[model samples]
Target: MTKGYIHIYTGDGKGKTTAAIGLAIRAVGAGKKVCILQFMKSLAYSEQKILQSIPGITLITLGKPYFIAKEGMLTDEQRKTWGNHIRIYPAGHPPKDYREMTLKGIEQAIDAVSKNYDMVILDEYNMARWYDLATEEETEKILKARRPEVELIFTGRNAPKEILDAADLITEMKKIRHYYDKGVPVRTGIEN
Candidate 1:
């Protein structure tokens, strides 16, 4: 029996990528091929290290380390905090080589689907579209072109309406409350 493709995970809360990663792990454990294209994120986290060790699973990172803040609208403190969070690329700038990397990652994911991978996870992809790094039409084309037998998971907040309408399954993580509102910072191994 062929598995249906297309899942969208979105909302103002968290756990989207975490859920997708869990699915990827399960797919790899079942001896099925799995691939994760991590968009708008750098490869510096512990999850990346752990997931890369899994057999029959591929991980591709397409973003340089940088905070995705609103342009020209950050306070000094916010700027400082974001500066700490941003990953400094080898070229000392983000968006320098990110476009090519993202495009390549997309192509690689498509190729993996064509090669009969059981699942593909596109992590933080919604943020890419939200930030205007990738267009909604382009994402739609990619999803529409996916092979029937390959399942796909998209993780991120604020997913586009078109994507939600096209998805077979959609999970929204609404943020009722968050510790960040109380001035809590992200913890390593837990938040990272």
Candidate 2:
């Protein structure tokens, strides 16, 4: 059997989840079964709609309707506009329900890795761990559950050193410049 390696797409830039989805399409095109578990994300993303209909792909999303932001990640006006749709929490103190949900997603991830999938993508999982919604040990458990022939991918920012150490391939999406800096809100087809 062919060996499958671990890949991590991380950093403060955008396109982490996009890269994972691209890979999923490539894998499916190659006649491989792919499973994607989107952590800390709801079905609000337009890609979720298309990903669900693709052959040889299974998509699972585990998140609340609202999104989470760290304190100071947005301006007062931005927060006001996103009020009720965004939860801004301090470091090391994520919302309890979100944490519970992440743990449950981890279980589902473990199950997916143990199955017959050729590739499994844990989208936004690094950010979930960075936000303290999940633990390194729990992430490692999902890593350990993977079959030898199943490729694993994790995407999001601030990936812990432990995760970087375990990865066979790591691609960091550095943000040299972004239109969002000029106050461009997330566009539906591009960012959301």
Question: What does candidate 2's lDDT look like per residue over 1-192, in tens digits?
Answer: 999999999998989999999999999999999999999898899999999999999999989998788787899998999888999999888888999998889998999999889999999999899888989899889888999999999999998877899899999999999999998998999998
Candidate 1 lDDT over residue span 28-119, tens digit each: 88888888989988887779998888888888888776665545556777778777764333322235456667677767766766676788
What global local distance difference test value does model 2 have?
Answer: 0.92
For model 1, the local distance difference test gives 0.78
lDDT of each: 0.78, 0.92
TM-score for all predictions?
Answer: 0.87, 0.93
Clash number for candidate 2:
0
Highest lDDT among the candidates is held by which one? Answer: 2
Best by TM-score: 2
Candidate 1 lowest-lDDT run of ten = 87-96
| Backbone clashes, each candidate | 1, 0
- TM-score quality measure for candidate 2: 0.93
Off by over 4 Å in 2: 70-78
